[model samples]
Target: MTAAGLPMEIRAEGLPTRVRIHEVGARDGLQNEQTVVPTEVKAEFIHRLADAGLPTVEATSFVHPKWVPQLADAERLFPLLGDLDPHRLPVLVPNERGLDRALALGARRIAVFASATESFAKANLNRTVDEALAMFAPVVARAKDAKVHVRGYLSMCFGDPWEGPVPLAQTVRVCRELLELGCDELSLGDTIGVATPGHVQHLLASLNEAGVPSSRLGVHFHDTYGQALANTLAALQHGVTTVDASAGGLGGCPYAKSATGNLATEDLVWMLHGLGIETGVDLDRLVATSVWMAEALGRPSPSRTLRALSHKE
Candidate 1:
């Protein structure tokens, strides 16, 4: 039994025994912060995340400095990650210009972001759904030609802050477009954290029917409504193995009001370990890392598990 008196046996049925956590603390997590983190600090954060045994760590974004000034040091940041395996570091690229910056910095993996709703598309990317897809098509094609892996992020998949609920067909169509454009994986994002297990299962079922295998998809959830963990379980039950999490629950959506940050890595690790699923992350070490980051950010981590464990320590 764990210190919390919880049994160590796997709880969820039909869930994958091993889950690959795509760590997003350095990129998606920090981008929403008001503070412009120093490039050296960002580098250190990524290094510590990788040192904590996270297999995949999203390094930074290649967007214009005027847009996301928090990560404007992307050019300076990528080179500091020479110690990390190139395959394990992915940076977010906004368009061909962003892609070019990432390529110039020798990025081997990149992620592109799109939205499932028109309001989000206009608010976040300044384009319609089709326009954003059209913009990403050539980006993905070029990345593939350069032998770089590409991942697609579809935000507001569950519910949009401005548009309310998103339709399943629109979500599936965006997923199909990214896949057809040669993206290696697609991460469905609950930008506003309004998803329930039923919504998650229904969406996965729709994507499955649309011929998108669970293997090619990842789930990115926010804990705004405290439903991130539940939604993650639902996705795992539907056979999604790649899960995106931030180290300390460090970010929120600037475009979507009241949207909390990505799901915490510590919280996800606790649940996955309780389920007897392997994530190859040491729970104590991960918690300590998050607490350390909390100190850096001058606030407590938003993860319940981290808060509890850090207090105990």
Candidate 2:
């Protein structure tokens, strides 16, 4: 490892030795862009992420173009990823139609997005909380029948814009429903990133009490309030291993105006490596990839690690 990229390793007790990073740069990161990223560029970005050893890279979402125009080329892009392992390339499917599009393209893994609050459900999905789950019911069943791996994303796990801090029971109830709906995994999202370490530990404990094991849960935190890393550490201490991050910190909820970018993969990797956790990622290559992407987006990366390391380069 290059000196610029390597962190001094100090193993932490009671933490998992290895972590699986669920990379979301290609899909979640670019979904909110006002200008569409070319299909070929998006494909190369995914390839680079895979080359950098991201275990699972979410490729694209199959939502209607009118809603997320940037990802409207999902059909065109999924085919270009044939050389990569299908299991490592999960796509987002908002409904049955999206599922059909993904399955037809031979996607072995898929995910559904849900909200913990009714206000977010209404804003993002145009349905009530129950109504949205009703929509995902058949979608999850059909995906399972097809033998596809499914992940459920529960947003506002901590707080919301229209609504205040979400109750633990409300988040737990929705998480249970999604798991019951046959979601193979659930990612708990701190949409506006208002969570502290205590709140994170409490939520994970509450979910464990509700019978949702930490093994089945993943943490997806935004850096809006600069709490993403601290919350992630809290989750790690509680035995949650899967973490969702975007390259270069390049995503936010289009519907949640106050929400900022995601927890940058480079930043997360720095922390994980410093704690002596194995992610099988080449931080040097990952930083290079994010730098290339930042240039493509015509902006500087928001990741502090990416910036500091790239400066050394």
Candidate 3:
């Protein structure tokens, strides 16, 4: 949306003074690295992110060690990050067992995922979409009973690797069931990051038509084709406020061969701040932290902002 005379970049949605950044670096970023980040380093990285005033950071995933060995220390990582305030540490629980382990380790917030495409479900979770959701239903129910907040992920929202473009109605129905089944919020994931502005606009429009309001939705995009930012603009124009981003553009799905890293935190914040949109995040500190994590893992950051900002005199 072009403002009256703002260079046709993006118009202000006049959103609230701030938006929450759900940092997925620790888990999402490191999980794909072949190098195992020592437990202390992982803990320290998480601590630094919290210290940077990033209100919510996804500490790590509690999936089985065999599935993602890097996050195998999910239990150890939690206590090591023990000093972090409790209200913001959201961990991903792959199933009931994952939730149980996370709860025992004192996680107050947890997340689970569902596939919008059947082939994605089969390949990722080894179950049909219904089977996967059925598996998650009890987990959500129990989490609600325990006063633990649950966030849901709906992967392949606009399109999928296996099934090609997904029906917008199917996306709406799954999202509605997730919210009705007790998810506090739903993140629409573009697994392969192939979503275009038209795809985003069409999906949101269809969702609104189906009585699915924008308030319940968050956007999770990959930068595979470098369309994440533009697609985000579409979501914002349509009134979807919350966004999920990973620091340094860290993390990609091992299963999706085409899945690139997530939208970079530094870059996203830069664009938002340029538009006078409040992300309540310090761009410098975030860039520093991304560099730290990248350094710890001995890899270069994927964030263009960090690269440019770090070289500032």
Candidate 4:
């Protein structure tokens, strides 16, 4: 985009002036790693992300260690992030027990993961779609009583591997149930990265017609089909301001083999900056952070923008 690898600013019409990036590199990115990253390294990685001007960084998940062994050190890792604002650091909780763990660590913001399809619910959580929501009901209720901010993540909004082409009505129903269960925000995930721009627009419009405003929605897209950015732009056009991205494109669904890496934060920032949309991220610092983490992980990053910009350095 530039000789120095920065994009030239040109504001786009009908787009939000500022966007909130929900950085997920620390939790979602490392959860699928075969080898466990040191708790100290995880702490430093989160600190670096915060230093790079990420306003809301998802720190870690409180699921059972048996399920996600990589984050077995949630207790150790969360305490080390004491330097960060609790409000800006969100952690994922699978249920009441997970919520207890996070609340014990003074987590002010938390999230619950749900599925829009029955197959994924069975595969990921070993529960039916409604059963999973029923389990989350008490968790959400308790978290709300604790005065904690809650985010509900609805996966497979676009398509599901087991159930091809998830119905729009089905996704909207789960989204509404999540909200009724008292989630402060909902992140619609294109889990397998099969979403196109038009599909994204249609889903957002459907949600709006269902009484779910764009202000409460966020988009999480994977780059498996290379449509992450395009789908993101469509969400922006529909007035959705929050977006979920992993730094250096580092995460995928552990249960779904078809799902690939998430939409890279650097790539998202590049497009947003080019469109003159503010995300408050320092591009240089973010690139450096990703490079550092890549070396720590013993591999190169999967992000095209990370690769392109880091090559210049």
Candidate 5:
């Protein structure tokens, strides 16, 4: 049995609660930026995130530089990552070539993406969803054989850019494929962030009934429709613990033209703390890290709470 005197155990409060945080600012947040952040800068950013108590940080993406020129330096960037104790940095691998590069660099974890909406799939991958999955089967198997842990990012879980809304059945189907491919975790992304609480509840319920337990699911939401928080609550209620949040709400949604912010790590931590959920994060230190990145980018943080906190001190 574990020690009953554990300092931060959630059960100490009465009920058992556990939540996991997946930090994505370095990749998801930085990729959408117009300027190509220098490779050195990117590594340093990841270092700061690791210092901020983020256990898992999405360090970079291995897509074609032509497609997302921002992260063309994955091979070099990842090697430069400062040793943040106990922080595991995962990168996004889009295909076989990306996986090969990750393997070469001795990367232990990577993420692949797909979409449920046909039009969005075509727009994003230039192929139908089924065709893209076919292409990924070998890549996923190869990574697994190489002892690389794979995570899948399924975009447009609630709504899409080209398509209006994604049906629960379609999302479920795509998620099933990802899980079947041996992805250790499947991140449900609100690409356009039009998801509402009710929609999230329905989808989570459907997914649970369909046999994809909440434990295998991670929630990624943007604040496009200002509903990320609400959707997050719904997921939490369903026992979905892992959440993907950007430091300082760094990323913007390309599909949702008006969507300017991601769900900020600070804000999410605050809410989770208020809800009596334990995240094992240091808010003051995390805010400092976010402010540092925001300053490096020479932009304002989308995290309203962070902005206020900075001004107060």
Candidate 6:
């Protein structure tokens, strides 16, 4: 039975026996929140997520404060995470400057954000696709020299809000470049939540053709059209094991109007457990953490798993 108490489907033949759920609740989820969650609260949230058995938690972004004021306390918050395994805490660094800050703060794992479409690249990073990659090239190189693990996030892999249905080849080219630039892993993001299962397959196929291995890739999906889990299943069947999820469905693209919150960690855990795949996450503890965070945000969590589990008598 699933966490929703629904009957489970037959086991997927090609899916990996275990999947790594990269918890992005602290960074991606909270960046778009209107409320400026205190540095202490953000630290507590990440600690709780780690306590729930999420080994890979995206801690915070070192981006400029003017753009994402919600996460302005990255400098302060990074130190508070001293107890966490540094290898497990990946922070987002937009450019060399951000990378410098992260390195200075002793961040051993960092992520750089790029885009598949010209419009999204321009909108999010204030640069064209190549220009953004150029900016990330040195950042990735420096992080590599520092012996830090670097993750590259390629957003708008399926469709862009401004330019619909991005070409699979275009996304693949960016993936290859980021890999060449020394990213240990590439996270393909459906930034606007427009990816379906077919789109996910096509994108993965194209990346494979570009010499990008499924082992070096992860999928990040938004649930706006309710296809996040289905798209994730497609990736899983394709042999992609790492997935990016936010706790309590607490995220949205601040720049893209069409983008919604990411696939909820609780919901994803529920489905993965039902599928007999190991994620090492405690569902009840994860839900309780999200519910506690929801109260901090002064709103209920959007996760169906959290909602259903919370209502149990």
Q: Which stretches of candidate 2 lie over 4 Å from their true place?
A: none
Q: Tens digits of per-residue lDDT for model 4 on 1-313? A: 3467988899988999999999998998999898999999999999999999999999999999999999889999999999889999999999999999999999999999999999999999999999999999999999999999999999999999989999899999999999999999999999999999999999999999999999999999999989999999999999999999999999998999999999999999999999999999998999999999999999999998899998883
* Sequence-dependent TM-score of model 6: 0.97
Instruction: Evaluate model 3: give its lDDT.
Output: 0.85
lDDT of 2 at 38: 99
Q: Which pairs clash inside model 2?
A: none
Model 2 lDDT at residue 73: 96
lDDT of 2: 0.95
Q: How far off is residue 6 in model 2, in Å?
A: 1.6
Model 2, range 1-313, lDDT digits (tens) per residue? 4674588999989899999999999998999887999999999999999999999999999999999999999989999999999999999999999999999999999999999999999999999999999999999999999999999999999999998999999999999999999999999999988888899999999999999999999999999889999999989999999999999999999999999999999999999999999999999899999999999999999999999999883
Every model's TM-score: 0.96, 0.99, 0.94, 0.98, 0.92, 0.97
Better of 2 and 3 by TM-score: 2
- Residues 1-313, candidate 1: write the lDDT tens digits: 2466332666667989999999999888888888888888888888888888999999998989898999899888889998878899999999999999999988999999999999999998999999999999899999999999999999989898777888999899989988999999999999889999999999999999999999999999999888999999999999999999999888878788878788999889989989999989877777778888788888888888888777762
Q: Where is model 4 poorest over a 10-residue stretch in terms of lDDT?
A: 1-10
Model 3: residue 225 alpha-carbon error in angstroms = 0.6
Cα-based lDDT at residue 160, candidate 3: 89
Ranking by TM-score: 2, 4, 6, 1, 3, 5
| Candidate 6 residue 268 C-alpha distance from true site, Å | 0.4
* Pairs in clash, predicted candidate 4: none
lDDT of each: 0.89, 0.95, 0.85, 0.95, 0.82, 0.92
lDDT of 4 at 40: 97
Clashing residue pair totals per candidate (backbone < 3 A): 1, 0, 0, 0, 0, 0
Candidate 5 C-alpha lDDT tens digits along 1-313? 1232122323223322757889999998898998989888888878877777778888988889988888888878877874543138888887999888877877788888888788777877888999989888888999888788888889889887667888899999999998898888899988878899999889989989998998899999988778888889888877788999999999965444645667999888877766667787777788888888888899889897687667662
lDDT of 6 by residue, 149-171 (tens): 99999999999988899888888
